[model samples]
Target: MTLSELIAQFRTLAFDKVEPYLFDDDSVIGWLNEAVKEACIRGQLLHECDDVDICQIAIKAGQVKYPTHPQLYEITHASLELTSINGGKRTPVCLVSFEEMDKADRDWRDDQDKHRLDPYFLIQHDTYVRLSRPTDEIGVLHLEVYRLPHKMSNDDDVPEIHLAHHEHLIDWALHKAFGVPDSEVFDLNKSEMAEQRFTNYFGFRPDSDLRRITRHDVPHTVKPFWV
Candidate 1:
């Protein structure tokens, strides 16, 4: 829904349709935008691999580390874009841990081969990427990743997530609205209940126990088995 429509609906549901609202338009909009972010991360709803700004990284010769997109939650796949050097052949790279690389080759971090072309493994911390082999020349890294939602500001702006998930986002806004600290309208009980309902639908958000949990809610969906 558009922000205006959603805000109106929120007022109706929140019983704040009357003027001198317990929540201001700015507050409601902020809560709604927060809801969008919570839903996106909790559900992995904003799956992005197509946008160049999100998926493509510019490589510097001999530079092994690169920053990831700020909104990224997890990277599912990555590869060095090799079209220019290997005649359009892409080289798929493995995601590895620092410890795993150290165990395999203790001096791996030395990066002696500045001219190395093929990278075998990649080490990705949440916000950075380190290549097994540094590039001989400038290159590109293509990544497949799950990202967070953008915050909405204007009344006409609708969330980027699928419309099916929009209605449920209200639960998060409700949770936040009632969660205001020490305000006359703040009710801890209402906040907790709203949060519980939000959790039931979106499977928990940034905090409150189940935050780190991953979901495979549908049938035939297997748990992630990353190597």
Candidate 2:
């Protein structure tokens, strides 16, 4: 649904009279933005895999600042290559803690030839990835990063989550919108119900394997250990 539609739906749920809107546009937009951010963080709905450049010139000794996408929230997978060849096959780099990366750097400094094959990364300042060593050559780095779902800015904008999950967004917005009391009573029950509904939908069966698995896929008997 569009941002306007979501706002309208939220108003319907939170207000008795729609002819005279109780909430301003900015107020509704704020609630919607919060809802989208919460949903994106809680669920794995927005993700993208793209090639990024770790510029050779950007390298200082054995580290290069890994560029970040605007909407990036987390990096799921990353691969590095020394050549510009797009499909030559790339090896995945292991993400390690700062201590591990420091060790790798020390090892490289001691004997570059001995640890030349090891490539590791540490997130620096929560913005850039600091490589243990600079690239042997210059090329693009491929990354699979989870992104923050886009905020609804325009009325035409649709959410990044699947359409089936869109209702949860409205539920979250309504919960926040009605959290403050408009009358003597706080209306805590309604707000809590909306919050619960959004949580239920957001975390619904997150770990279940969606792939079709049948009995044929299971082993009927155990085989010998050696075999």
Candidate 2 C-alpha error for residue 178, in Å: 1.9
lDDT of 2 by residue, 15-97 (tens): 73455566677887888888887787678677776434322113333445665655665666666655433354666766554
The lDDT per prediction is 0.79, 0.62
Best by TM-score: 1
Output the lDDT of residue 50, model 2. Answer: 44
Residue 6: error of model 1 in Å?
1.2
Candidate 1 lDDT, 36-136, residue by residue in tens: 88887778887888989889999887688899889877677887765555675667777767766787799977756865554567777767888887776
Candidate maximizing lDDT: 1
Q: Each candidate: how many clashes?
A: 0, 0
Q: List ranges where model 1 is wrong by over 4 Å.
A: 83-85, 115-119, 206-227
Enumerate residue pairs that collide in model 1: none
Q: TM-scores for all candidates?
A: 0.84, 0.70
